[model samples]
Target chain A: MRRYLRIWRIFFTHSLIQDLEYRLNWWLNAFNTLLFLGSSALVLWVVFTQADAIGGWTFDQALTLLGVYLLIEGVTVVFLVPNLNRVPQYVRKGELDYLLLKPIAARFIVSTRYASVWWVPQLGLALAVILVGMARQGTLTAGHLGLLALMLVAAIGTLYAVWFALTTTAFWFVKVDNVSELFTAFFAAGRFPVSAYPGWVRALLTFVVPVAFLTTVPAEAAAGTLTWGWALAAVGVAALLLALSQALWRYALANYTSASS
Target chain B: MRWRPRASLGDVIRVDGLRKVYRVHEKEAGLRGSIRAFVDRRYRDVVAVDDVTFGVAPGEVVGFLGPNGAGKTTTLKVLSGLLHPSGGTVRVAGFEPRRREGAFLRGITLVMGQKQQLSWDLAAVDSFLVNQAVYEIPDAVYRERLGELTEMLSLDGLLRKQVRKLSLGERMKCELAAALLHRPDVLFLDEPTIGLDVTMQQQVRRFVADYNARHGATVVLTSHYMADVTALARRILVIDHGRLVFDGDLSALVEARAPEKRLRLSLSERVDRADLAALGRVHAAEGLEIELGVPRADVARVAAAALARLPVVDVAIEDVPVEDIVADLFAQGRAARAADAVRAAHEAGAAAGGRG
Candidate 1:
């Protein structure tokens, strides 16, 4: 485990240096991220002004949910999405040969080889938004904050596992570049509370794609309304999905015929 | 060079009846064909490697020689554990390559000419460090090996530059350094000298030779350039149509396929083509020079006769080139396949006659 962590450290440092080389790109990406956050916040503000609550949640609650969505998006774009998106290209171009020859796990090398540093500022922005919502609600407690942290970690794990399982399919189907786009589209629903949708849509979000675990559960924890049952279920679901993703990755690797065979 | 006895050496790589079949999708050209393909897709099985069997000693440098689509790369892939074989067994370093155990992966490295493992946006040294971490090399060992590889490959200033900023030769050298940082026992190189200039090709060839000599690594190289094979490999494996056609010493291959020598004569005066033809098969004749293909047993006699009977000013004798020998071998393989087809047809006809 320490060795894997060291490898990740080296990879992250390399990415940081590469990212620093293009100073203009860093500024542009940061500006774009801010613009996206601002637009989403504007939409939330406009909706909350028209009604006290759209789905039995107040303005502060909705703001906290939006913050959760941005935080998860920040993590995905920074670490998981860029690397996972390259899996199909590697398979198609036969570049995976290099990865396969490494002494480490091929899946670990491919998934964590790149981490985009430019998107990290969005994560900071997400923390600011979440804090602002908590300040507005005047509900600051040590126990609630601790629970929110645990729930946030579980949420991120669930998201990572889901994304990983989807991208691992690229080993078998080389043309699945659009799979991540499907994830993004489904994840957009997390911008609102799962309760806002109908009963069936809520169940789909909770079980099928599990976007509710990513946003609603964590947001509820921050709002001090998360039940013990939901928190335990979220942790259990995250563990199960993580194991499932690992098995799926192994199966996909075994099915890899390699290009130019 | 003379052929040496290889039976005394212990084989580190043993492959038996290895086969790899690929399922490739087939689609036609026209709109109708496209629609038909969409409605009813067809996939054909391509036998990339067929019942090929060979073995390599612990320190042997073997050249895999073949034309395009002759399955040289496929064989290397199977041996390196990149592609699983459809049938048969392969053992490298006393482990099944397909299993890809950590010990197996650590003991071998595969370098493809067209593919790169360096981080393109970072300095080559950074990529080397990444490899150091991946292979879990100790800091002291990593520094020592990096120093050795850098000096051997003349990669002092190039390691600090971004990989994208380096020239092709420079990048190739760095690629070699990165691949060898761990000092793997077995090296699988596929067209490692492709697209390089003559000088660069020679540099890479010399590097491979020195590295192999210094480390005693088992090297299996696939290349179209005969110079690469001739300079480095003494034993050559010739593959054609997914089959191993020839596997033996380089000199033995030349002797079996082309039992002749080339004699070039610079005459004092122009001679008749018929007079030159009487001595040997005239390959080419210019104003005052003639090239002859003489059998190996009669080369000395022919040279003496030409000097005594003709106004020869200069004469040179040389063995047949490896390129010509390989081309002839490929041609012979084609002919043998054709003959086998005809014989099979005749047998079938006879069987049909008996049935009637």
Candidate 2:
């Protein structure tokens, strides 16, 4: 585990250097990220101006959900999204062999090997939104804040596990070029609370796809509506999903007819 | 393919009847099958590796010689634990490759020419640092190996340059350094010198030879370039169409497959095609030059006859190239396969007739 962390640090530093190598690209990508967040914020502002609340949550409460959504999106785009996009190409081109031959766990190597540092700045914008939402809510107890932190960690783990499982489909499904696009389209639902969605869609996002664990539950914890039982359930689900994803990864590795082959 | 030697630390790697099958989706050209594939895909099994077996004794250098799609890469992937064999057994440095334990991984390294392991935008030295962490190389050893490899490969100044900015040869040198950071006992190199200029190729070949000599590392190299094999590998394992066709000394392969020497005659005037045919099989003919293959024992007689009868300005005799010999081997494999297909078809026809 110590060795793995060392590898992860190296990977992170390499990624940072790679981004810094091209100053123009670094600035342009950062601007691109802000433009995207600004557009999302504009959409939220326009919707809130029309109505004080969408479904049960007020505008401030909805912004809190958006903040959590940004946090999760930033995490995904920084690590999981880039890695998932790489897996299919590697599987197709057989580039994954190099990672497989390394002295570390293949999952850790593949998932965290390369970082997309461009998306990390979005976390700042997300924190700003979280602060504004907290100010509107007036106060937050220390216990609730602690629970919120735990929820955020569990949510990120669950989201990463879900992405891993989805990307592992490339091993069995060969032609997964469009898988990421489909996943992104569905994951966009996490920008709003599950309560705002219809029953069936909510159930699908909460249970089948688990986007609620990625955004809504964390936002709920921030809104002081989070229950300990559900938070435990989220942690349990994340652990189970991570275990299942690892099993799937091994199965995929066993069947991976390397591109060279 | 058999593994009677059993488990022993002396033998770093052992392979026993390893097989790999690829279930590739099959689709026809034209509009009909393309549309049908979208509705329902069809697949067929392709035997990429058909019972390949070889072992690397610790500190030995071996070469895998094969044309494209001959399963050399497949066999390497299986040995490195990148791909699971459809059947058979393999052990790499006392560990099952499929398990991919840290010990097994630390014991080996694979260098692929077509794909790069370095971070493209980062400096080559940074890539080495990353490798250091992954391989858990102590700083002292890492520095020593890095210095040695950098000097040997002439990579002193290039290490600080970004990988994308470096030349292909320089990048390959950095790649080699990164691979060797762990001092892996086993090295699998697939076309390590592909696309390099002749001088760079020689440089890499020298580095590999010296590395193997100094470290006593077992190396398995695969390359289309005969020069790479001739320069580095004493023993060559030739594969054709996913099967081990020949395994012996490089010289032995040439001697057995191509016993005859080629003689080229540059005449002042165009030689008659018939005359050349009468002397020896005409390998090639141009305006004023003719190349022929003659038995080694009869080379003197053939050269003497050609000189006396023809307006030969210059004559030279040289051994057949290794590429030509391997090509001939592939051609022969194809012919044999065609013959088997015909024989099988005849048997099937006869059975159908009997049933009718």
Candidate 3:
């Protein structure tokens, strides 16, 4: 475990350095994230303008949920998409050969091989938004903070699990741009809390794509209203997805035909 | 019949009847074809490696010389476990490569000059560090190995530059260093000095020779450059159309596959092409000079006949150039493949009682 952690650190730092290689790129990405975040907040503002609350979520609770969505987005963009999204390209170009040759797990290397630092500004802004919402509510506690951290792990794990499983399928399909795009559209549903939608839509958000685990659970934890049942469900879903994805990745490796060189 | 390096008991590498067939999707031109392909794709099986078998003893540097798409790279990939063969068995460093066990991975390294393992936007050293961590090398040992490679590869000033910014030769040197940091017992280098300046190629050649000598690592290298093979490997494997056509000592290859010898005669006068054609294939007829392409076994007989009959003043016999022989070897392989196709077609016609 320690060895894997050490290798991950090495990969992480180098990837960050690579992302910073172009000075303008870092600034541009940061600016792009902030603009997207601003547009998202505007949508929230317009939603609240029509009514005091939607589906029982207070303005503060909804704001915290949006912040959680942004936080997860920044984390995945920085650490997950750059790697998982390129699995097809790696398989196409035969780069997976070198990765597979490594003594460690190829999945581990591919997952942690790159991480961008451009998400820093977006993550900082997200933290500010979440804290502001919590301050307005004045109900956050040490226990609640601990629960939020746990929820954050579960959220990131769930996100990585689904993306990795879908991406690993590229080994067989080799192209799934439209499918992934549709997934992105589904993920964008997280910007609003599950409570904001009707019963069926909430079910889709909570169970089908699990945008609820990504945002609502963490947001609820930050809001100090997360129930034991929801937290258990979130953790269970994350673990199950992780196990399934890892198995798929291994099966894909065994069937991997290195691109004709 | 073709020669195969016999597989010994303790050989570091052994391959027997190895084959790989690629299933390629075929599509026709035009929108109609595209839509048809979407509904029902046509597939073809390309035999990339066909019944190739060879073995390498520990510490032997073997050259895999073949024409493009002749299965040298494919065979290398199969040996390294990056690919699974469609038929037969292979054992590299005492492990079945397709399994890619940790011990097997740790025992071998593959370097392809056309591709890179380094991060494009990061310094070469960063990639090395990643390799170091992943390979689980102790810090002190990693430093010592890096220091040695730095000196031997003249990698002193090259490690810190971004991989994309480095010159090809510099990047190649760094690649060699990165690949060898783990001190693998076997090395698979596919065109390690391709596309470099002659001087750099020589340097790479020298480094590979040195590495093999120092560490006693078994090496399997492939290149179009005969000079690369001649300088580094004593034994050469000539593969064509996914089959091992020739495998033996360098001198033995020259002795066996060379098409013909040149018989040069300084005659008292220019001989008629007719007269020389009777003796052998007429190559050239100049003033008081004649050259004939005499079969290797008939060089002496043809020379003696020329000396006895023609107004011959001087005579000499020379072997055909090695380069021409190599080119002819590939031509022969192509001709053989064509002949096989023709024979197959004839048998098919005979069975079907002729068509067209």
Please state the interface RMSD for every predicted structure, separated by commas: 1.6, 2.3, 1.8
What is the docking quality class of candidate 3? medium
Question: What is residue A97's positional error in candidate 3, in angstroms?
Answer: 1.4
Q: For model 1, how does the per-residue alpha-carbon lDDT over A128-214 read when each residue is reduced to its tens digit?
A: 888888778776678877888899999999998988888877776678888888999999999999999999999999989999999
Q: Specify the highest-TM-score model's number.
A: 1
lDDT of 3 by residue, A1-261 (tens): 988999888877876676666789878877887788788778878988998987778888888888888889888877887787788889888888888888888888888887777676788888888888888878567887789889999999999999899999888888865656877898988888788788999998877888889998999999888899999999999999999999999888877854455
Clashes of 2: 0
| DockQ of candidate 1 (2 decimals) | 0.70
TM-score for each candidate, following the candidate numbering: 0.95, 0.88, 0.90
- The two-chain DockQ for each candidate, comma-separated, is 0.70, 0.57, 0.60
Model 2 per-residue lDDT tens digits across residues A1-261: 888787788888878776675678767867886787778878889998998888788878888888888878888888887777788887887778787787767788788878888767788788778767867885466876788788889998887887788888988776777877887888899999888999999999989988989888988888888788889998999899989989988778766744336
User: Across residues B179-290, which tens digit of lDDT does each residue of candidate 3 receive?
Assistant: 9999999999999999999999999999999999999999999999988998999988889889988888887777777658999989777666788899999878787788
lDDT, candidate 2, B4-109, per-residue tens: 2333456777877888888777788989989988789998889988987777788878888888999988888888887777898888878888778888888889
Native-referenced Cα lDDT, model 3: 0.87
Question: How far in Å is the alpha carbon of B264 misplaced in model 1?
Answer: 0.9
Best by lDDT: 1
Please identify model 1 stretches exceeding 4 Å from their true place: A258-260, B1-9, B267-270, B286-288, B311-313, B349-356
Regarding lDDT, does 1 or 2 come out ahead? 1
Candidate 1 residue B122 Cα shift, in angstroms, is 1.3
Candidate 3, residue B32: lDDT: 95
